[model samples]
Target: MTSHSFSKFWSTDLTRDSLLSLLDTPTLKSLRLVNRAFAATTSRQLFRDVYITFRSSTFTKPARMAALERIGWNIRSVTFVINHGAEMFLPPLLDPLTGEEVCFVFTPCVRTTTPTSSPTAPASGSTSTAAGERQGVYGTWEMTDLLVKQYPPLFHAAMNVSSFVAALTHMPALRHLKVSCAGQESTHRYRRSVVDYALSSLRIAIEQAPLPRLEALSLTPIHPGGIQYLCPMAGIGSLPNSCRRWTQIRRLEIHMDTFPFDKGQATDHLKLLHSYLQAFRALRDFKFRWVGDGHKGPSPLSLATEPALCELASRSQACPKTRHYLRPLKFPYLQYMVLGNAVLDASQVSDFLTEHRHSLLEFDFEQVSLRSGTWDDALAPWRTLSSAEYDAAWGEKQPAEVEVMEVPFVLGPSPEESPATSSPEQYSKRRKKKKKKRHARTTEVAVNNDLFASTAAMLLEEEPVHRGSLNFRTLREGLSNWARSKGMFWGHGHGHGHGSSHDYLHKAVQSPILV
Candidate 1:
């Protein structure tokens, strides 16, 4: 018996596909050198999906970007990792009298051969113009922005949104995009300035090169839960129109720190983020997540009422002329959505689902809630019992009703095209309305909350959290009963590799369940 050559077997279509699937990036790159045929095959796959980082040694940003432009045509999926590098700091300014460093600065200063000094400068340098013939200056010079924008990946992810867009311009064929920021923390002093600049420059770059082909996008910021007050104190008009450039997008995921204020009523951030969310009208899949502790983030609050969120509702912003009116976040074509650690109004969520009932298939509330209404309100569809009172329940909607209709006698091949019969062909009127059709739809919302987070937080903080609600809603026994009571199907959190029963008892906050 004759055996087939290994080369011949390896060249088979099945074998090639298996090889590509099994091999890692390095192996594939090396295999390309085996022959010209392999080279052509591997080259396309090699760059089809790429993950690039801009972190340590970010000085090579230009070279990487250039290389991206070269291989961009082959890239369809890319993840751009932005590093919140070690604190961006500058040398402390020396006291002119003492010549000893006084304070460190985050803002960069300009260099000069012979520069004028500030009488009371933003920079820490002295006002003595005669101090040096070169490089000793103090004025209202903000060099941090210029440098940060120049190499966005080296800074915080929240600080360089457009750098992602700029990189996107290179890949006209790009489809799936993920921009994540996770690195060393920066001082609080620079966050507001850098983030403000980032937010301000968002529109110009996007309008310059809208990645029309983009279908899926994920924006994640790995910053700690604290220090979410990154928004500018002044009005930074963030509107839904900012993202209209990508309305054609199908999937979107956003991970934000929290509402703008550290502890107060700040609707501007909420409105702006809402605008960002409302912009995606054509989305089919969406996720909105807030990084919080114990899944005990508070519900929405008002200027007058004390905020359960952020521990205070005292923070306020000037009522700019561009202040936004709260509206239901509409996504008519949405299919699946996940809300992780989110704070939303019941009516907003209910109306959002009701308006697009025909399109939405799956909805999840992970380590969060549906916020259907206040705990004491009898009319609520779903409610969380909390020590703090929440917004009134979303008034009940008319019970879901089924609508029936009649279809044509001959629906035809594709329903869009049916050959026009010549005068020779005829059909009976009785057959025209014989086929009846019925249509009805249901919205599924899975609320997976940490039933015990409140109890834990009570120990660490002064406030009290609602505990019994999750026991009746999210826990397996309660959830199963809730589902069966509502005439809906329910499933436990168990899986092929699920944690032990004790884990469920101990860390209920981390689990995600569906109904």
Candidate 2:
């Protein structure tokens, strides 16, 4: 076996497709171990796209990164599955009449940073070496400055932001990056504040690191257990004022989980998310997904049963009102968009598409519910779909909100402490500081960087969603008179999407506001 054996084998012993098929069985593992040349040849095919859980027991990250190092350059994309916790304190949920599983775990966050049109085909059964199986592949790329993640109970975080930052160094040729946030079980070592640390570190990593080839970013929300409901799972609004706009990103995808069992309070973090999204001026493709009603059972698919983070009814308190969440969002370079599991008015969706009609080529709708107007009425801006109908508005045609954060300002300039890492004394001091005259610094329009921060409350804007009208029956009808009349073009319009921030990070971070 030799380096050139792959092409030779393809022509003689195997075809490229057959060799790739060997990847799924035990035979592939044996073939790689037969000889170094065989290993190298197989590795080029095996380690193309990498997924790391960072679930290592060894204190040093060298053991964890060793496998990634072997095929560092061989890697084209990487996914870091941060194991944050999920909620457990809510009451029970009334089962849906049907037995199908319901979930708030929208899995789109795990999508690789490749185009949905032509995604990078994965090497079947690819994986890094188990830590103890062989001598470690240490620092081949020579990243001496890679900051190691601390492992003490107080310092540990499921999100493992430190490990993620360290992992970024090895992925030089990386194009797409995904941080799929989740945790199934609770641990005493975990701290709620640690979520902020992970997000802030993420922003810093992207801003400071030289990801010259990086193009896509995707984030799923975080929902953890114990009784404290994590207001909004880590999403765009979590980034503080100091975080910078990531102009390098051309694609953006966000997967959001709705409050289980109940809608919780009246807050609109989605609007804040839309506000944050405008910073990515270079974005071309966008996708948003939501999965609600995950509280139907005890599994990860259904974590809570009562209501948001927790039930206020049991605590005897009233939920407060907040402003609307969704508005027309614009992207200068957006050519395509995909939206799912959302609630919107026909006007908002039509307005957004009309706004982007010049730059956008086409947009797809899935599992979306309209609050008012018919599909035929809402999509009228484009008049008719000539081709999958390129429209100008590459944005959301929905209404949304959640997690009322106290609207935090960056505290001076030290990166906030990881929840598990911070001591009680530090937590107490920060809590006291927050209790004091914090709003004194807040202004009518707290101009942080992009948008204003409004703490003022508004009347309840609870409009009933047309559950019947949520489906895009007409959009998928392909070529039909009714569908065409309602702006359905040629092929069924589908979507794709994929964000980071720092600075306010060196400062302390704020937990999202929950009712």
Candidate 3:
């Protein structure tokens, strides 16, 4: 039998797991060439992740589009990467007084003249230029309008949107859609306009068709209005009715690229947030972050400063701006709440936590400035719940006590840090000397280890830990030895990975080293 025939038979007989074990892309692509049987088995994996990049040279070409069109059915995830310069024309807003198009920005006029004896000369009626002109005689805005309207297929505009949507609609099995536009567009005033346009297109496309399997979405919007555009409100920007179709989405992450700069007043922003959050009913994990510019960590509260935060935190009463909007929020299905770089009113936040305490498993607030020393006060509602109340609601007994033991263990420098030397003998001596030092420290800490192990073993037999600390290094080392000497105790603790907190706590009570 030929090698191809043998491989074909082998591929057909292999289990799904076996086929998936072949990790390299080239190998998977080659398997499709082996035979129809191999092709059938491998095609799903080959086209699972589809990436469409929008660039000046490649966006117009139909090769990538054709491939995507053919195999879009196999796509499970699709990512759209738009280039920096791809921008849409923002038609001049009409002036109320003159009722004429008035330029919002100061843009210089650019005139063009046809060259003599050029084969690609302007048409008889035409004033000037090629289709892909970087700058038109009128200006960048005019150039953008020309490209988007005249040669829509060649530019990242409505045509691109329609094509992308068509491709997405073709994939019935798609679960993830990510639209990323990095860097500012030179022609456009708002760098986020490209992202806004892309999302708007997707929203329109989604309204027309059904994406039953889509459950996760990720995108970065530079403007606050872009979010409003993506999920349009019903009446007076109250409820986002357009996002009703996205109820199937369980995970939504919005990256606000220029948050502090673009953000509105705290109340106005929070009102917008309340409207947006109400749109997703079945969402489990929601993350909204403002990726600061140039700062290493989270952006400083530029708009929502410390004093304002303190004022908000000082009172349990919700902000007047968002009081009505946030009063109704009780995300029963939410499991993870990760918010960063944005300030939320303390009272509203407390109310949210109290309402969702039973459902929320993990809550993270990174660089979220609040009134100084008010974090505990903000989370007080959750802590104030009685043990009986917790058990009644969650069907799990809360830990009655907490033990904190600090076991000191020396964290010496790594033994592998040998000094640089010209002589091999010198290098060998340095290594030996480091090993001797480590051994001495280890020997000296032998008594400390015994003390650590005994404490851990004793704590294992006690009631569930409410809140406590032990030297992590000592606990890790001592626990292993203690487990061997005394049978492993199932420590009553949170986040034991059994999925349900009830199940985890139940098992903790039922089983004896409680981690």
Best by lDDT: 3
Candidate 3 lDDT, tens digit per residue, 122-234?
32444434432324322364545543443333234332333445555568788987767566532343333444555555565565445788899887543444555456453
**In model 3, what is the error at residue 434, expressed in angstroms?**
92
Q: Give me the overall lDDT of model 1.
A: 0.48
Error of 2 at 145 (Å): 25
| Total colliding residue pairs, candidate 3 | 11
Which regions of candidate 2 fall more than 4 Å away from where they truly are? 1-18, 56-59, 86-154, 157-163, 183-193, 221-245, 260-264, 294-328, 384-515
Instruction: Tell me how far the alpha carbon of residue 376 in candidate 2 is from the true structure, in angstroms, after superposition.
Output: 1.8
lDDT tens string, model 2, 433-500?
Answer: 87663453243113321110111111011222422342233322321233234432212222211101
Which runs of model 1 end up more than 4 angstroms from their true locations? Answer: 1-15, 55-66, 89-167, 183-190, 193-206, 222-244, 259-267, 298-324, 343-348, 370-515
Q: Write the per-residue lDDT of candidate 1 for residues 1-515, one digit (tens) a residue.
A: 23567667666878777778788988988988989887777877788888866443321245766776777777888776644433332224444456665442322122322111221222224545433311222222333333333333323333333344555567888788776655434334234333333333333344445476778877776343212222222223334354456676799877755534434334454534544555566888887677644443332221122133223222234544543335445667777877777555555454454455556566777765544574234223233422222222222345679999997696446422333542223333323433321111111222322333343344335422434333432445554444445432223332412354335434433334321
Worst 10 residues of 3 by lDDT: 110-119
- Candidate 1 has a TM-score of 0.49
